[model samples]
Target: MKDDRCEGVIKDAWVEQHWGNPINRLVTKVEACYTKLKTWNRTSFGHIRSLLEKKRKLLAQAEALLMTRRNHEQLRTLKGEVYELMVKEDAMWHQRLRVEWLKAGDLNTSYFHSRATQRNRRNFISKLNGEDGQVVEDEQKIGEMMASYFSELFTTAAPSDLDPILQGIERKVTPQMIQELTREYTAKEVEVALKQMKSISAPGPDEGLHALIKQAAAIGTISGVSLCREGPKVTHLFFMDDSLLFCKANSHECNSVLELLEKYERASGQRINQDKTQLFFSSNTNQQVRNSIKGRLGVAVSHQFDKYLRLPSFVDRGKKQSFSYIRERIW
Candidate 1:
């Protein structure tokens, strides 16, 4: 309800009201059962089962009585209670089942129940495909495989000549483009961005009051930095502290893109963590080509990739494949 970070912070009552979560209904159901079970003189499983049956019969009788009486106020109260119970049940099943992308709604409890089971099953990695074309089922061996794979991935490679590819391309960025890209960050603009972020993301944030000072300093540094994409025709995406650069696979294009990144780092007093950077190769790119690309950028090459923006960036993303993650939310 209250936070040490900021005075009079977000409270559970407000969240339950605004978020439309059926907290009261859930408590009503579970608390009654918990209390009844606790107070019972017997402690055996058989007695517990009988107690549960008794509770259900009592609820059923109460419902039947309210229906037969047909008092308008009673009917309305009972109807509202039943709806709340339904909502609470839906929310419970959804939470327990761990449905990531779907909200609790009509008739999804049964589906969520099954997905929870599937999630549990899928989490257990009984086997893994090793890079050496060997099946590794042992947990220790899987750990070893991952550690070794990533070690080689982040390690710096021997330098190779990038001059050949750099010579092959013509410059697309001219003086006008350079002038536009050279736009600097102003303190006023930085303050506006910080204020906007505070309003939207400050309440019930990841880390509470203690993080305010840290966030201000970090965000201030971030605000002082600015980087625009190479050309108006190019598409560049930025999220959080991450940046993604898209360009032609050719070496000239790659070199140009890298150069722009380097310039941005120097200008903004920020640097990219090359050890964590990765370069994904197309299916058609041979080992020799991939190696050359990695050498130039000092980035690791990855044949397989995972989700970004909750969507998979697979090597062979076909029309059907592109929408596969969407199917997960359909339930």
Candidate 2:
């Protein structure tokens, strides 16, 4: 009976091993099928090619679906984060505006002091003559006296309550009135007005010459003026003069820098002769000259100035167009 029981147990164990779990058996069968499919070719004796094509299509679809879902979830998360940031930024801006309004209400004493000082200097220079040197004592004393006089003048000044003579002057020369006068005046009228003005406040020609000579002498005495900073270190770059005022971050950056420089010149009462300025950038290896320039303050380098042997066919247009025009046509 014991021997019979042992045999039955062995048989049961073998059956269990052979059967296993249905899920595990299915997985093993799938793996075997995959391996066979991978190894199979035209010589294989199964429908492996058709089966592989079907499996591949199914896998591709599954992967595409997963990718789409992931991208959607990521985009939603980013949008929510961006919205939160914007709300915070708006709150900060509102807080800043309130602070600015409060600050604006306070007396800006430093601003007034600097402005008053500059105005005093200007007025002193306007009225000053060499004969008044004794009255001023010294240059430093003159500056202090001018400041004090201006301070007193400002203290005594009334708002729109000018003396009749000053009021008449204001009535005649309101900014709008001046603008209208300017519009009405012809070149001949302007010339006549200037002549009358010069006659009324004329310095002798000798005195004018002496003043100009003094100015020249003063400028000549300024011995320690320095030049602008050194140019950039890029190999393919060149500058026409010592004006390191321009920058070339890239093609776009270069254009922007040129525009900014032009704007600055307008604002600062300076002029830029673009005809004299040289701009350089890398182009195709076969292009002619490494540098080019444009006439006047134009930022667009002329095609004629470009020496690149492999000049793009589209660059022949005489009119200035966007860089995109050249890029699209060339590349």
Candidate 3:
């Protein structure tokens, strides 16, 4: 973006004659500028990885020559060139990972590369379960399945009145407040709001879902697992959108949990991603009961849990032994 050639290309593309409607005219300019930039990037910038590798190899050769003969000036030039390419490589990975917090001097190119690769691996869906309880592996079939699933999931329905449901809830916002919320905003306000927002941020927590599950647990509709003799019964644990629901190994509670999930899906217009969902049971839970609950939930059973939220999921009596990985971490 800071390249002089890039600026020239953009200026040239913008000056090109094009006649169209206002929107089309704007799009044409943008498309032309994008094409020019793409070509410029290919020709001038080239591949950052390949360029960085070449620079590193040259640097290594320079260092080897320096060891045999003291050519300080040549070694310094190669070092500077390698450093510049390293910065460029780091910047490329930072943009790919969308990490906004990293500063210019933090040249963690390899770390960023590994993190981006890990993210790609974690997000890629090689297979998907269709509605008919069959696994879909074909790329086209998976795409079609996702499209169909999301289409039905997001299809809007007729608006419904909320007065009856919201009547008992205390009003936090007054009519005047509503007017303030609905009022038009000036350009300055929009600019300030946009500037204040982060490049990426986590979504707000859903307290309503927590309330609904808590209500179910309160009414004994769903049982929770008790960790110790006197510890509080943990019905459910939530972090962002991922949830861990604890319930007894029984058919009745399983059905109730499924009903609650269905209600949540209907209300929120969001369905659970079965690909990432899994069930873990205590050692005392027999194979027969595990199989029954697994069939009912239609989620895979996990026999081992390494970590959740960067901490060990299951800890032993010896705290030091359970937390040895903490000491093993790089400083």
The Cα local distance difference test for each model comes to: 0.54, 0.41, 0.77
Error of 1 at 310 (Å): 12
Name the 10 consecutive residues with the lowest summed lDDT in model 3: 159-168
State the lDDT of candidate 3 residue by residue for 261-331, as single tens digits.
76566555567677778888888889999999999899987745467778877776778987877888954
Instruction: Give the alpha carbon lDDT tens digit for every residue of 1-331 in model 2.
Output: 1123434443443344434698887666556554544444223323433544555565455556766566656455545544443333333333323332323223333554455456566655523333345544477766777787556544522223223213222233588877886775588986686776622244332112122222323433211112335642321222332242322323443344444444434333344554445454425422333222232234544344453334432343454652455677879
On lDDT, who's better, 1 or 2?
1
lDDT winner between candidates 1 and 3: 3
> What RMSD, rounded to one decimal, does every model reach?
15.9, 38.6, 8.2
Give lDDT tens digits, candidate 1, residues 142-244.
Answer: 8888789777654544324433334333468999999987899789987787776622244331211112222322333212113355533323455665556
Index of the highest-TM-score prediction: 3
Backbone clashes in each candidate structure, one number apiece?
1, 7, 0
lDDT of candidate 3? 0.77
TM-score for model 1? 0.34
In candidate 2, the residue pairs with backbone N, CA or C atoms under 3 Å apart (3 or more residues apart, or in different chains) clash, namely 274-296, 287-308, 287-309, 288-307, 288-308, 288-309, 289-307
- The prediction achieving the highest lDDT against the true structure is 3
Distance from true location, Cα of 197 in model 2, Å: 35
